[model samples]
Target chain A: MEKRVLMKGNEAIAEAAIRAGCRYYFGYPITPQTEIMHYMAKRMVEVGGTVIQAESELAAINMVYGAAAAGARAMTSSSSPGISLKQEGFSYIAGAELPAVVANIVRAGPGLGGILPSQGDYFQATKGGGHGDYRNIVLAPASVQELYEMTIEAFNLADRYRMLALILGDGALGQMMEPVVFRDKEPIDLPKKPWAVTGTGGVRPHNTITSIYIKADVLEAFNRKLQAKYAEVSRREVRAECLNCEDADILMVAFGTCSRIGRGIIPIAAAQGVRVGLIRPITLWPFPSDVIARAAAQPSVKAVLTIELSCGQMVEDVRLAVDGMKPIAFLGRSGGNLPTQKEILQKIMKMVGR
Target chain B: MQAVFKRTAGLLNIPTHYCPGCTHGILHRLIAEAMCELDILHRTIGVSSVGCTYNNYEYFACDMVQAAHGRAPAVATGIKRVHPSKSVFTYQGDGDLAAIGTAEIIHAAARGEKISVFFANNAIYGMTSGQMAPTTLIGQVTTTSPFGRDPDAQGHPINVSEMMATLPGAVYVERVSLHDYRHIIQAKKAVRKAFRVQEAGLGFSLVEVLSTCPTNWGMDPPKSMDWVAEVMIQQYPLGLFRDPKLEESK
Candidate 1:
């Protein structure tokens, strides 16, 4: 039987990771996400797991890299500035195709912006922030329920794709407390990892995990194979939620914490006699562009109002998805300020001439 | 009626790609033989560090993972923690282990991670050509230190083994040189001892092998060996610096 509990988003993610068989947790304390490291530190030891408070964010992520390479379920969490420190390790993990979970409870960015919730890191999360041509499987959670569910899914996706999985949340989401019912208490049946560095034991030949392909042709071949895997993921794993867009005039595209605000504005716009629908992207990387394009093809959909907490990061993807068939407008308040439902409704009224 | 020359039981018979008179070949043989003798060859996982021997995975007859520059220690720590039943070790070069990977090795040791570290100190970066390394002698001249290593400008050379020995978490730490046949034997013993400590599930063990880079040293193979014994040893003395067994006796 599933148990109901009142938990913050950060605590929920930590619990979900433990129930999902994550045994190693390495992290450094940072705002809005410190509860995750605190929770894991107390719980992991009780369950015969390991929790390490690394010296720095750089050390924490490398510890994750180490644990993941050893075939253990591992994770780390931090905010914007801390995540920046982890970029090098994250890139190496991605390049090696090692499975690990990184939770970014984003605050304002571009150098220690603020400690409040912001979606400024949308571009960094989607586009590989470190050196090299690589991609991370980014999962954007809109609520406490999603914060728990997506963390489990993040581990699964990371293991499946042999890549880093990011749980992209914000300060508001991490700090909010809500009722959450776990899916099940059943033990997770992880797939066998034949590629991990868990020793040979004479059962098989030695396996090497590496990203250094010096020869041009060899590296080219590796890049082609990686591209193929990415393509497969994009075709099969793109996910998003569409709310009441069949007969709507304006389509509102948002994700993460911004999606909740967009959802809140939905009824307000409807009461004002302005038709507005919300399209929330669940997976930000293998983006749900196909869904957006299909919605844009509808004759009733005239414009896409992209609401975010950044200047215009995710708005670029919405514009690309809409493909100029409909005019795309953006409304945002960065550096820790959130757009309220009243502000969103006013923007919709201005757009629809209500 | 019997084979006069045969490949070592644990070592792969493939001819090594190391330059003539390179000590890496000898070190590999020692590790392989140790694994075979200990009956842990099948259960051993080697994490290869970034350097001239980055492709060491091809040489070891065990599971291997090639880590990014300075990350092998972290990788080995991961593998060891996950599969405690398996023997895990990292083979790193002076530049890879002592310079770029200083933090990684230091933290791994401080955490008392049960793994073996084989630090090959040639005092120069061989893979990238004769560049000055962290362990490069104070007066040494290389491509990057053509004016000779200036103590004020380039900083002083680091004694990695001695420094590591001071850490309380390190159960075993030793410095050995492959300058002569006798010292080469001692170096092999040190390597084997480090592996043995890890196999016994003791805390972090490290063996720093003072080696010679003949091509980079601008000397012939034999002359470089002599230089290692006569000069390198003067700056970086070789001997056991820490041993858990010694502490137990007291």
Candidate 2:
């Protein structure tokens, strides 16, 4: 019988990645996310895997790019500024169509804002943080246990799509500790990469892994192919949770730490004679748009309030999903300020004419 | 009748996009020959940096990965760490290495990564049409330095080989030239030795080849060769800066 082991959220991610067969980890130290690197540094050695405290985030991501190009499961972790530094490499990895995983334990930022949790990077993660026509599978896990499961699933998704996968959690989730049961399970599906850059050994034609297409037409065709892949992902890979969404007049849309607070609000609002439902997005990219659309389509749902740790980012996606079907409101704080349950409950009270 | 000359199997039988009179073709040939001679062609994975040879992946008869500008060293380090038994190398130019990628190259050597680097120093940015490079000599004129490079204004050129040799992890550092037949032969030897150092797991190795860019240098192909010998060689000297075997002897 397997037993539950108490682990930090960051440690769960590190340990889970190792179990998922990630042999290469390159990271540079950054706030809140530093523990991920520390854990990997200690454990990777025991597993005979390669882990390096790179000189900078740029090098770390490029290292992931190289290892992925060579057909090895590779990942890197960093916070806000560090993730910004890695954007160039991320673009290259995406353009080259290499499979890689990156964890952004997001901290407050427009620039060096604070080491506290903030969901300010929602736009950056869901949209293009790097300069290019590309997207990463952004997995937003709410708890330590979810962190472990999603990290393992992230590797498989990255390989299946030949795209980058991002574990987009904020500082609060990164630091929180809880009991995590590391499951003994096999991969969902690990596909063979025939186009990896491992040496041909004179048996096959040499494989060239690159993103450069000097001709305009060739590049357009490649972009079309990538768009088709993303379209398939949108149709098949969306994940979200809808709780008490039926027979409800008010719906709260949130994710990550905000979603945890949202769950608490459901009970508090219940005592106040208010009916509220919540939809928490698990996949930020290829976003759970259809689920959101379905929840908003419920005639009993009168208003949708999008709460977050940012001024507003994912609210835009929420608006698009709702599509003027109901009145939408955004309530939140930005720059390391997290919304409390009391604040959100009060906002809901005003919205429901309490 | 036996053929007097033939191309190395290490390079593909295809045309290259390099400008006429550019020595990139020569440097590519020397490195390809070394890969063939060392019998490591099958297991060699090359990192192509952003420059003239960014697409050289198409020319080398081995696996290749193109890296972001100045990030090739870091990329190559990742590849080498994963497949310790496989041969890995990066081909980078002056702007890619000495300027933008200075940090990566320095740290890769400092960490004693067992990978080979083929550095091309043409004293100008060839891909972007002749900008002033980090290895551009004082008083040397290019598109960016139309009046001539001034030490007080643009700073002095970097002697990358000498700087790299200072790092203990850089076990083999050599600066060679492809200005003439004799020096081309010597440069070939240096390229081979760089790979041999990585194969021996000695540490990092680099071969800085002083090459010419005729179109960007505003000279004929023959004059470009002469300029490398007379002008470029003065700033970036050709010599072995570090040798693992020599250190062992000492």
**Taking the candidates in order, what DockQ does each have?**
0.64, 0.84
Across A1-354, the per-residue lDDT of candidate 2 in tens digits comes to 669898888999999899999989999998998899899989998999999989899999999998998889999999989998999988898899999999999999898899999999998888988998998899999999999999998998999899999999999999999999888486534578889877888899999899999999999999999999999988889999999999888999999999999999898898888889999999999889889889889988889999999988999999999999999999989878888888898899999998
What tens-digit string does per-residue lDDT give for candidate 1 at A150-255? 9999989989998899999999999999889898546698878888877677787777777788799998888888889889889988889999888788999999
- Minimum summed lDDT over a 10-residue window in model 2 chain B is located at B241-250
Which 10 consecutive positions of candidate 1 chain A have the poorest summed lDDT?
A184-193
After superposition, which runs of candidate 2 have C-alpha atoms over 4 Å from their true positions?
A187-190, B246-250
lDDT of 2: 0.92
Point out the worst 10-residue segment of candidate 2 chain A by lDDT: A184-193
Query: All candidates: CA RMSD in angstroms?
Result: 2.2, 1.7
- TM-score, candidate number 2: 0.98
Question: Candidate 1 vs. truth: CA RMSD?
Answer: 2.2
Determine the backbone clash count of candidate 2.
0
Q: For residues B58-151, could you state the per-residue lDDT of candidate 2 as single tens digits?
A: 9999899999999999999888888889999999999999999999999999999999999999999999999999999898899999999998
Looking at model 2, residue A241 earns an lDDT score of: 93
lDDT of 1 at B41: 87
